[model samples]
Target: MYAVIRVRGRTGIKKNIADNLNMLNLTRISHATVIPETPSYDGMLQKGKDYITWGEISEDTLKELISVRGRLPGDKRVTDEYVKENTDYDSVDALATAIFNQETTMKDAGLKPIFRLNPPRKGYEGTKKPYTEGGSLGYRSENINELIEKMI
Candidate 1:
């Protein structure tokens, strides 16, 4: 799966890019969503590339993200007990494994789809430029895990 995070604000955004980000459920800066890797999602990510960052998420990062940021319907922190009670998984780690393996989704696992993250610890390097140029926008490949760690 690809972990996508909105990096820019809505002001001055073009309608189509805004629509793409909205469709991805990234309506605000620092908001993130995980999506299966697919052609349509790729197109959407490309459309909003100037205002977001994304890449394949590592299982360890994904697990930490879920354990630290995952929430339930009533804004409760997701725990192993909750996972056992609400889903087939016996622990949060198992759920994370399942999600990483594409065997389940956050929604199906009874977690909220959107993860509201704090801005990266040291903030972005440069939000206006692409990741290839030492900026925080655009795809960052496995470096996305480092970024996520900072945010978490």
Candidate 2:
């Protein structure tokens, strides 16, 4: 799975890019969503590259994200009991594993699709430039995990 986070706001955004962001469910700055890796997703990410950052997500980070930020329909925290009661998984860890393995999605697991994250603790490197240029946008490979850690 890939973790995609919106880094910029909507001001001065082109309609096509805004539509891509909306379709990715990253409607606001600092919001994040996990999606399966696919060519279609790659295309969308490319189209909105200037306003977002993404990369393959690690299982550990995915677990931590689910345990800490995953929420139920009523805005309740996900617990082992909840997972046991509602799904085949035994706990949040199992759910995270399933998600990482592409066996299921956050929505299928009964959690909100979007993770509302705080801005990174130390702030971004630069929102206007690509990650290759030491900015916070575009792809960052494994470095995305570090950013997620700070945001979480």
Candidate 3:
């Protein structure tokens, strides 16, 4: 079963959850990660507004790079999707370990904050939108619905 423990304001993990989860022999909920896309990152990496290609760097690569550039490394589609789909398991594991662990929390000002432990099952249908790397995940932004719908 997916075990859950409600917490607030306690951002960093302590030994308690780790030890408990260890005894339970189940995965604990992941720490938060900030999403990495912005008009700036796009401007830095993207060639143009249209469907332009950057040799050896396809749309998926650019997106992964953007995701990497943006900071949603924990989610595979955002990070590992750039790697060939059929890439070896070890390679994927290495990438996951190296990249996913580097998480960030975006706290947008327009949306009200409502953090959660998991990715939304049906996009914005879940409790809160995902965080961005150093960027607010629309936390207190008035664009909560749009942020949740598009970014979560």
Comparison by lDDT, 2 against 3, better one: 2
Error of 1 at 127 (Å): 0.9
Compute the lDDT of residue 16 as modeled in candidate 1: 85
Which regions of candidate 1 fall more than 4 Å away from where they truly are? none
- Pick the winner on lDDT between candidates 1 and 3: 1
* lDDT agreement of model 1 with the native: 0.92
For model 1, how does the per-residue alpha-carbon lDDT over 19-110 read when each residue is reduced to its tens digit? 88999999999998889999999999998999999999999989999999999999999998889998999999999999999999998997
Q: Give the TM-score of candidate 2.
A: 0.98
Q: What C-alpha lDDT values do all the predictions have?
A: 0.92, 0.94, 0.29
Better of 1 and 3 by TM-score: 1
Model 2, span 1-152: residue lDDT tens: 89999999999999988998999999999999999989999999999999999998999999999999989988899999999999999999999999999999888888999999999998999999999998999999899999999999
Per-residue accuracy of model 3 over 1-152 as CA lDDT, tens digit each = 01111212223545564443333222333222222345553342222211111111122322233333333335333334533343332333344333333331222211111223343344332223223332222233333233323322
Candidate ranking under TM-score, highest first, comes to: 2, 1, 3
lDDT over C-alpha atoms for residue 34 of model 2 = 96
Model 2 stretches astray by more than 4 angstroms: none
Candidates ranked, most accurate by lDDT first: 2, 1, 3
Give model 2's clash tally.
Answer: 0
